[model samples]
Every structure is written in C-alpha cells, then in structure tokens.
Target: MQMSNRIKEIIEVILNSKGYVTIGEIAKQINVSDRTVYREIPEVTEIMREYGVQLNTVSKKGMAAVGSLEDMKSLRISLGMEKQIYIVDPRERIDFILLYLLQQDDYIKTEALAIDHHTSVPTVRNDLKKVKEQLGVYDLHLIQKKGEGILLTGSEIEKNALMINILLNHADEATLYQWLRREGDVSNPFTKRMEEYGYLDVMSACYLRMKNIIRDQCELPAMIKDREYLEYILLIAMMIGCHQKGQPYEKVFETENFKGEEQRVTRQVKRELEEEFHILLSQEEEQYIKWVLHMGMIQDTSSVYTVKNRILDSKIHTFIEYVEDRMGLQLIRDKELKESLYVHIERALTRIRSGMCISNPLIEDVKKDYEELFGIIREGADRIFQDDFFPDDEIGYLVLYFAVSLDKVMKRSFRILVVCSGGMGSSKMLAHRVEQEIPEICVSKEVSLVGFGQENLDEYDLILSTIPLYIDKRNYLKVSPLLSSNELEQIHEAIKRHKYKTMRKITVREQERRQLESRDNIESLETLRLLMDTGLRVIRQFRIVETREKDLKNNLLRILSEESLCSLPETEEKMKKQQSYYIPVTDMVYYEAVLARMPEPKLFAAHYHDDQYLSNGEKYTDVIYAVYPDQASEYEKNILNRMLESVIEDRDIQEMIHRADEKGVRQWFGYQFKQYLAELLAV
Candidate 1:
C-alpha cells in the first residue's frame, strides 16, 4: 500500500524536527480535521506497506516516527518542501509574550516587556491573551511570576534545535544541500567530492558531521564564548568523527596539567580498544579521544565501547562475528576510505537489544546493496543453531560450507561420523550422500551395521540414521529415518502440545488468582491439585475415545448421575450432533465409597464403570475428589474398612442422608459420603 502525499508529508515533518508533533499540528499543515488525520494514518500506513517506518505514541505527548537516515531521506524526497514550512501565527498579546519568552535569555516581567517595547502594562497584559490560542497550534507555554517575569515552560524544541545546529554548523548549508541534490548521481562532481571525504553512505554524512566539529570548535550555551576554547571544542568533535570513520589520527591536546594521569589513562584506552575492536590506535590519540569523549560529548560515551553486550571494536571482533554468523549479512565495499563497521553495528546491536530475535530479515536488507564477497551468508539454520528437523541432504551441505567459514576465522576442523551398513556399496552411498548434504563435515570414520549400536555415541554431536539404533548417553539429536513428511508433522505436533500445556498452566493460575475476588468453594490447594490432575487425565483420554452413539450416551449418563454432578447445558445443537463427545462442565464430585476405597484419592481421577456419571450423551466431565486430604496418608486402611461398612448400612438411604447433611451439617458430610457412593454404585 502507498500513503497519500499529504500523510507522507506529515511523517517527514515530524521526523525532520525530531520532536513529538501533535495530530493537530499535522492537521493544520495539511488543512485537515483531527479526526481526518487520525483516520488517514492507519489507512495511509497500509498503503505504504513498509515496516521500516516505526510509529510510536509518547505518554502525554502525541505520535512520532523513528527510522534510519536512508529511510528519512526517502521520506523527505516524497514529501518535498511544503512539509518543511512552520508558521508562528499568534492572535493575542499572550501568544506574542509566549514566543518572546521562549526566545529571551533572561526572564522578562510584564512591566519589563512593556518598557522594552515602549508600551503600557495593559498593552503587555493584552499580549498575554494570545497564549491559549498559541497552545492549540504548538507545544509551547509561558509562565507568569505575578510580578517578577514571564518564562517559557517547554524547552524540547530548543533542545532539538541545538542538536541540529551543532550537526549542520561544520559544513556550509549550500555545499551540503548541493550534495544532497545530486544524491543518486553516482558520477556527479559533488558525489565524487563526498566520496573523497568518505561519505558514501549515511556513515560518510555522519563522518562529515563529526569531522567538521573536530576541525572547527563549538560553543555550548553553558560555555563562555572564547575563540581558543571554541577552536579546541571543534577539534574534539572532529576527533570523534575520525574515530567514527575508523581513521587513525594523532592527538596533540596539551595535557601538561594532568600529564601523568593522561598518560596512564591513554595507555589503558589504547590497549582496551585494540583488544576489543582489533583496531590499534596510538596512545596519544587514545588519550585525546578518551578525554574528549568523557568530558565534551553531550551524551554518555560508555555505550560506544559496549554494543549488544560485546565490545564494539574488540580484538576478537566478537560482536561483529556474532552478528555476521547470525544475520548472515555484511557491509558495502567503498574504496574511498575504509569505513569502520562500528556505526551500523551499534544500530544493529541496539535493535537486537530491542527484541530483534531473528537475523534473516535484517541481513537480507543489507545483502541487497552489497555483493558476495562483502555480503555474508548465514551458516544455514542447522549450523548456527540446532534443529531436530534438519534434512539429511541439507545437513551435509550446510555443515561443509559452514565449517569452511568457521575455519577461515577460527582455523578448526570439525569431525563427523557416518554410521552405515548393509554392504560397502550402501555405506559408500551413505558417505557420498552425507558429504553432499554437509560438505563441511569431515567424516572421521564410517562403521558397518555389526557394531553400530555398540559404537561410541560420544564422537558426534548429531546422528543421522536410516535405521533405528539405540545409543543412550551423551548430547545428540537423531535426524530420523529420513527428513520426511511424517517427521515434520511429528515435530509440529510436539511443539503444539508443549505450547498447549504451557497455556493451560497459565490459564489455570490466572483463574485461581481471580478466585480471591469471590467466595468460590473450590479455591484450595488440595482442590486445585485434584482439578489439575483430573483435567489433564480427561484431556489425554478424550484423544483416544471414538465417536459412537452408545459410547457418548453411556458416558453422558454416567456423569449426570454422579452425587454432586450439579448441572449441564441443554443446547439443542450439541445434543443433535453425531460426533465424538465433548462436555463442558464447571464441577464434578466423586462418590465417597469410591473416593475412600481408591488409594490414590486424586481430584480429577475418574473410573466410569457404569452410566451413572454421564448425562444425556453429553458425557461426564470435571471429576471432583471428595476425600478428606488430612486423613489420606494415615487412614487409608481405616477408610477402606469404613467404605465396605457404609455400603451395607446406608445402601438404600444414602441419597436422602446426603441431602439432609448438606442442608445442616456440612462438616459431617464426609462421614455420609461413603454411604451415598455405595448406594450409587450398588456394590
């Protein structure tokens, strides 16, 4: 889907400003209602169909967009110049006061503003009237101090402006704009000049931004304006830029005040950077970079070294290797100057931290722009991670190629064992097939059928088999008789069952916690444990029961007649169905005689020997255990003896006694439960 030109313009404007612009602001820009703007967003997004543009809602603020520099450039090209325009139209004196308040360095009282502008206090008071009107258009406000002065309340816009100014101050706008103008013209003179400065991609642009800052000094609002201090600041920014571009440059900062301190720190930084990034820098440069980064940069610079839990420029390049191995992608080749993979790497690392679990999508995007030598191929799904479903043919191919890549970096050979038999022809065929499937796998040995079962299983991490053989110990996964349809189906079913079990536990726990909201009789440890055990048993048994009228009707009758079966639905559609039985019930109760005599005494355990537990072919469901849990362990023999006695004594009057007990003496109800169970069972 493609977004309308209007909505596209709104997104570009929001991103370019780097501030949370409200829906009203966007509406005014395109001359639309707040409702219309909200309606267009989702619809326009569907049209664009690009996941690269991220939309987020800020608390107490409005919507905002975040994307890469390339994504930003694309958006800008689509929106054109209409989106860049900002109008500060104020209708009242307060609005004017607010604007002036935001711009002024010192607080200005209404009396002061009146005197400065040669106007009366009433005139200045009248200017304050426009403040509310301006609030509807922009995220700005003015504070009145009764008599002291009026001050600006919001400073987000100023913060953004400061950052932008710092970034753009190094290169003249004309030169940068011209380079931007001929963006796609690879052979253009401006492009060539940018290339010479190492600005091939956004990395180059960032390099320039840093380079200019280093070459020319900057003065923050907090600093007293001085040419010498300003010059040093610019040099500091340039040094950061050079470090960003992966360039090695000497540092000449005067460190006489803390020469010893600087020298010790500089040595550590150089050693650390070299050990981490595999890139070496002189001790002087390292110290200069460290001092500037720690003291000069606005944001914390510690993150520069730590990218996604690994050192960014470490000697082992652990992060880079991990990303390459996982993402299966690489950087674009540029000869103008070798660009460090650090910039893109940091972003990717940040993304990984933000829940990017899979690397294929990110890798594929990079591969589109870089060729084979520069582009990385993920060591297939099998090599990077374990997959029980990996095919025998694909396995060999993946192993061979993946091993070669690992060998290039780590210089290690992997040993593989091929277990085959039947004859030399079959064994040779298996070896050839294995070699083709995983070209990188070095088959150290091939064994025949004679000792295959007795052979050491510890030699291989994975086993491929055409026939079943048992080797019980060690870390190993069997690829199966073949990577066939049945195997895949089995894996899918296993995963589904695992997921369902997890969901069941979560659902039951949530329901249990919710019981605190009401007086639910079933909410107790013993009752819950019984319910869990019963539910799982019923779930397992139902999978095997076949559909038949006799079976369904009998099961339903058995559930309906149970002592505390309570109730069930009378849905006509369910009754008319001639399929496998399914019962949805909230409660069930076990007969006391059965509960007492049974040794396990579990909540969900059900043994339907007759039709008493079912009702109208709906099938008996939700078996409830009725035994006293405290007496379970010690009184098992006593309970069985009482169960036989109750059968004979209350064989006829058990139901009547139960109803009477339920109404008056519920505590003594367990004593009569065995009698009711005996009569119900007619045993």
Candidate 2:
C-alpha cells in the first residue's frame, strides 16, 4: 500500500531512535499535532509490517520500530530514501570523478561526465582543478582535449598506487571489511560512490578467497595480524581482481630486486593465487605485492628488528634524548617505549620517502587533548629528521607513545587484589580491566571466593571484587566485571579514602591513638545500633520464590506488586525508562541469570524464575531483584551494593535463590551480618 509523506516521516523518526520514542517527540520532530500522529499510527504500522518490522508502543514511553538492520534498509529503499545518484558534497564529488576517469581508458566528452555526475559542466570543470593538484602528488597529469573531456595520463604502476591511496584514505579497515563482506550500510556515501564503479561487486567476489590465501599461504609475523595486514591483503586482492577483469591498468613488467624473505613470501602468495584462482600473476604484480608486504611488516617491531637499520636506530635514540631533555623526563630508560617508537617512526619514514600518506583518524582528538605535547614532539621530529617531513598525522601517533610513557612514569601504583567467584577466566578478565582502566592500580593477585577467604586481607592496599564479600572488610569495593564509568569514579573515591586513612594513622602519636580509640568506641556503639535496625528489616523482608511466568515484564510486575515492595505502575515506568538497570550476568551456565534494580527506596530482595529468552537471545531462567533505599548512608549503600554483587557473583547464592530455599537464604544473611558486626567491633 502507498503511504503518505507524513506517515513516512513518522516512521523515519521511530526507526532513528535507539530506544522508545514518545508520541510528543515524534509530533515535535514532524511539526504535527499529537492527534495527527496518532491518526497515522495504524497506517505506519501496516506499512512497517510489510517490511518485517514491528511497531512496539508502551503507555508512557512512546514507540519503536523493532527489526533487523537489513529490514530497515529495505524499508528505506522502498520509500525512495536509500540511494542518491548525484553526489552533493564537493569533496566526495571530486573523489568519484577521479575514480570515474581512472576506470575509463578512452577519452570521454565533458557533457557525458557532467551528465553522469548529475551536475553542470562548470561544476565538473571546477572539481577537475582540485583533482589535477591531487594527481600531481603521484606525478600523474590530467590531459584535456578541446573536444574530448579528460584523460588520466600516468604509468600503470603510479595509477594503481593512487587507487590504493584513495581507498585507504576514504575508509579505515573496519569500514572496508564491512563493505568487502557486503555488511555495510548500502546508502553510505563511500559505498554508494564505490558501487557506481562496481568496486563493491569486485571486492565481494575476491574478499574471502584472498583472505584465506593470505592467512594460509603467507608467512606473516605475529604482530602483523592486525588491521594493517588486513588492509595489505585487501589492496593486493583489489589489484588482482581489477587486472583479471581487463581493467585499464593491467600491463605486466619485470620484477624489481627485493629482499630474499619478501621474494619468498611473494612467490608463495603468487603460487597460491594461480593454483586457487586459475590466473597467473605478472612479475610487476608480484613486485607490488612484495613491496606492500614489506611495508606491513615494518609496523611490527619484532619483524623490523630482524633486519636492523643502524642509521634509523641512531636517529630514534637521538629523538628520544631530545624529547627527554625538553620535558625533563628519562624516557630513554623505557625499553618498550623505545622499541614501539622505533617501529612507528620507521613506518612513517618509509611512507614519507615513497610519497605515501597514512591517515590518522585520531589526529584532531590528539591535538585537542595534548596540544602542548604535540607541539614538542612535532618540533623534536623536525629537528631530528633535518626537516618537517613528519605531518601532523605522524606527529599525532608519536604523541600517543610519549603520552602513555609519561602517564606510567608519573602515576603512583598501588597493589590490589581482584576477587571473583572463580579464579579463572572471569577473574582474569576483571583483573585486566582494572589495570587497563585505572593505571594507578597494579593487580597483586586474582583470587576465587575460596582463595580470597583464606588470604591475609591486610596484604593489599585495596580489594576489588566482581562478587560480594559477605565479610565487612575495610578498603573493599564491589565493582562490575566490566566496570562502567560510574564504578570507575567510585574506585577513585575509594583510593582517596584509603590514602586519607593511611595518612591519619602515620601522623598519630601514642596519646592521639589512645584518644582516637576512645572516640572510635563511641562511634562503634552507634554503628552497631544502626546496623541491627537495618539488618532486622532487611532479613524480615527478604524473599525467594519459584515462578512459572514466561514473560519478564509480567513477572517483574507480579513480584514487585504482590510483595508490596513497589507499585506496579512505578515498576513498569522504571523498567521502560531505565532498561540498562536490567543486566545479564552470565551465559556460560545452563540457565542465564539477570539482575534488576527497583526504583523504590525500601530495602527489598527477591528471586523469580521462568523459562524465557532475553533480548540478546540467551535463555534466561532466573532474575534477581535488589532494591536499596534512595536516601541511604554510606554504610547502608555499601551493604546493599555488596548484597547485589553477591547475588551476581556467588554461585552458591545463585543456586540457593534458584532453588527458592528461604531457610538457606536467611541463614546466609545472618552469618554475613555476624561477620560484619565482628569486623566493625574489631576496627
């Protein structure tokens, strides 16, 4: 059925939102009344159904079009919103024009070129000026005849290099992979332009086969298995496919002399291609592949060290010394930093010498964040290299290396113990995350619940656990295995608290210690009084029940309302507004577990179970709900957070909750409370 433009606009707004879009939001976006939008809902829903999209609406939270990305793309195409023939952006138009001319062997008329681009002859003429300057970089020329339109005059080798450069500069490896695999958005500007020249079709045919040949046949270094190597394989495949299809740049030439290893690897690549694809590679093609492979290997320090360049090494040492003297730092002492810098500088020098440009996508970000450091490095590079050969892109990369080294040298490291349910994969992952996110932390050990219980707690400055520690240990914080931003801030605060305590202890005299002990006794008494009151209320209200409800939202409503913990509408609204509060804990086990928070301030804990699939397609068999008071003191908040973490991390607690063992749950809570009291009085 044909839909009106208003209905299409409403559908577009719904599809664009990542989450639920309210009726008011849609109305405002389309400049219509809420009533008019309501009138169009049925028609919009009907049209969406044809594309396998479901229009899901909630009472308070508006509506969302739920479907696969492909379905959405198809719906957009049906609405005539996906592909545009004419390029609008001037920069993009120049790129497409260059690609168009390079793919053609015969000279075309200016009018035909203008018609293909859907632009005027004057605009095409203006774009050709910039294109000419770009061509000059590779020693290529744009020759125009009075009658004939234009022709790209250059060696096959130089033209091929320019083509590869354009592709690299246009998209990064991830985007290229998506395009080559036919997984990228078809309407993207780059994809649309490349498709106009049939580049996508050629890449789709050669991508997987070339990937396999490179992986199985080439003797690649360990460190070169990243994006750089992927790009190298992509370019080689493109050159080969373009040659086989009788493209303009297919002339063969004699191979140039290369290193023994590069020649051997290139021969294997050529043999594999000829055997598998039934096409022989010319010597010039072999030479190009060999050169590309060598360039990729230069990024790997281990591979570069295999063939030492004394001059490059000497220059790098001098560069490091210059930066060290300027910044009053001892960077020369860092061996790893020196090695990484050497590899990057070597790659940068090669690209510079060969008139090749490497794009740094993060150059602007690096300049903004480290403006002063960027200037110093740029100056050092200019002085050491005897000219300003390094562009801002290369300078930006160098700045990152020194920035990281400087961070490590300046930050004070503290020993930490990372605890989890098991001292295995999950614990190691958490440990790595802590060290990566908080460089000030040095993980002293990764321990399981059982291992943590037996260790001397005073050995480490702080203990971070993915699960709850029932015992009330000082300097302990419960954190998610995958730490979020808020949790990171909490960790920083915990470090500050520990530092303050340590300073107080160090400065205290014997008399001050005695006085502090006397004051602590009074505070301990008050803490005990508050703990008993909160503990009784929590233990009395704790609940565990086995449920048969299959729908997650329905089960949440039933549990929350039936227990009188929170009202149904409040729970529903919270669920709709904050979907992120519902977290999936693990999927390695037979039954998936999810933890959810309640909006209410009352202390409440419960377990509900049913056989259902989570949004991620995991089969969820259990849901643990934890509600902490909105107005809670530090001690109370810590207790509730740890309790929730225990439900998330402790397998035993999970098993008990899943079994709906009320007796066991109560007993565990009592024991944990006792431990908390004992630790409090001891302190």
In candidate 2, what residue range of length 10 has the lowest lDDT sum?
586-595
Can you write out model 2's per-residue Cα lDDT over 474-589, one digit (the tens) per residue? 23677888888977876776566454333222222222223335666677567668767777667667786566766545665677677766777865654422122333333212
- TM per prediction: 0.26, 0.50
How high is the lDDT of residue 270 in model 1?
50
Each model's C-alpha lDDT?
Answer: 0.40, 0.67
After superposing candidate 1 on the true structure, give the runs of residues whose Cα lies further than 4 Å from its correct spot. Answer: 1-288, 291-421, 424-464, 467-683
* Candidate No. with top lDDT: 2
lDDT of 1 at 439: 57
Model 1 deviation from native, Cα RMSD in Å = 21.9
Residue pairs with backbone atoms closer than 3 Å in model 2 (clashes): 601-629
